[model samples]
Target: MSSTSSTVLRAEHIWLDGKLMKWDEGNVHVMTHALHYGLGVFEGIRAYKTHDGRLAVFRLREHIRRLLDSAHIIMLQIPYSEDELVEATVDLLRKQKQQFANGAYLRPVAFMGDGAMGLGAVNPTRVGITAWDWGAYLGDKGIKEGIRAKVSSFTRNHVNVNMVRGKITGQYVNSILAKREAVLAGYDEAILLDISGFVAEASGENIFLVNKKGVIKTPPLSSPVLDGITRDTVLKLLRDAGHTTIEEVTVTRDALYIANEVFFTGTAAEITPVREVDNRQIGDGKPGPISKYVQDTYFRVVRGQEARYADWLTYV
Candidate 1:
């Protein structure tokens, strides 16, 4: 991580209305309608600097599609098409002179165009793509370090009320509050429960547990959890790599105390091992084997080692 190495790796490459801006220099309006109200859709996409020096984005099409789908759900009409998002990403990478030998991270956001708010001011949606050098979202706190997570006292917004499937701006208020509560409670993060008292997600990431039989289980999207792109990828990776995974509807507070192991996933956090849930140790209190497998295989797929998932990447 030398200064030159840092410069060579993970420099700011962001897009604003087809124009490239320095990551720090990127700006938006203070009065933007979406800023005031969660009226826009966004995606957290990742690209890695591969061993071959190729910068490959993981699940480009799928992530953009999700962003577009989110936009459509909110009735926001982005001026660009799916192809345009992909093209803008490519052109931005080339202009930034990004090193293709390694993969990098990517983010694309589509929001209502700048204006004061009226409830129905979404006919003109503005879209932008931004990317930078980002590492695992587990933060500087490693999974082995074992962070604590508090079960949020505040419940997540119901799908009936907030349309939880879409990645809207306001949806994160629940996340922010839960995270803040965890920090105040002297824990690393928070786990949010859906309205029905089922475990929906751990703050921004999805949750998984190992049953007494050593089977992997995760909550289905039928719960309040937004369909995470990484969660989807891991489900495919585990199954393809020959592991049995189950989607269970069970969400008892007791389930946390009886699990062999538990972990969380997201674009930012990647595969994070949860050693403790609510102060209870998870399976002798260490990152589990299955969690490690998911982490190892996921980075491989993102880095383009797994040809089976290569379609998920866009090599630049």
Candidate 2:
């Protein structure tokens, strides 16, 4: 196994195929079925360094449950129960305390191993869990000062064509294309529209817009958006903060242009405000009051400052 580097930090150990292994030794066969067919499901979870100096994973159980649900959706049965997987994640983190001293990002994935080589192939299932220190995915500046986004020429997957509810590994090709297009075109992020021209979501994040009327709106599950955990947390936070006008409704692209504020949410992006869409400045081209409030509150809740949301944290 190779030693860690400044640009690339490897966990001391990783959980693979039901056991812990050295990080460099956790390799799969070259002909792994999922590598060719993209038949897999996964989840992105985060652990936070609490205010009192403890490490806690945010919504760990919920993320594990969703991973199982995604596997079920694609008919790929994971070998372990949700509780077992959760324990494995905790154990993995425990073994990497120094590496993940500040916080960590966990990826739990289940996929098909090498076997038959066709679309209808049935192969053995393999599960792996990896954790590593990570920072703001969209860049720290993007999270604080807000980011610029463009409505991608690529459309979101139609409901029947791809399973929108499942975080399937193969299904993210659409997101990759959109994200690359945006980056190549000099934009920070991409916003994809649904088939019917309704605003869907960012490449890998759920979107929320605050309109001129102080109403917060996001695309419903009926739309082609993912059921993002961070999106759910933000909704709950908004309601608990006594904002009564939160609504899950169909939104058009033009609505984003006219919105007083826009933002993206996900395990990776967290609460990232969108300062501009296609060169049009959003609310004076700065993070709006509501966006900043939600971002601040989210960080606090994740880091264990909000006692009311303690149930959402699982200590490592």
Best by TM-score: 2
TM-score of 2: 0.97
Q: Where does candidate 1 stray beyond 4 Å?
A: 1-13, 21-25, 99-103
In each prediction, how many residue pairs overlap at the backbone (N, C-alpha, C within less than 3 A)? 16, 0
RMSD values for the candidates in order, in angstroms, are: 3.8, 3.1
Cα displacement (Å) at residue 216, model 1:
1.4
For candidate 1, lDDT tens digit of each residue in 1-316?
1111133244565788767777766677776788877788888877777657677777778888888888888888877888988888877777665443344566788777676578766545667776666655665455555556779898988879877788887788888888877878777778988887888888789888887888778888888888988888888887887885565565765687688878888887888888777888888788778888888888788777877777887876
For each candidate in turn, the TM-score is 0.90, 0.97
Cα misplacement distance, residue 120 of candidate 2 (Å): 0.8
Q: Which 10-residue window in model 2 sums to the lowest lDDT?
A: 1-10
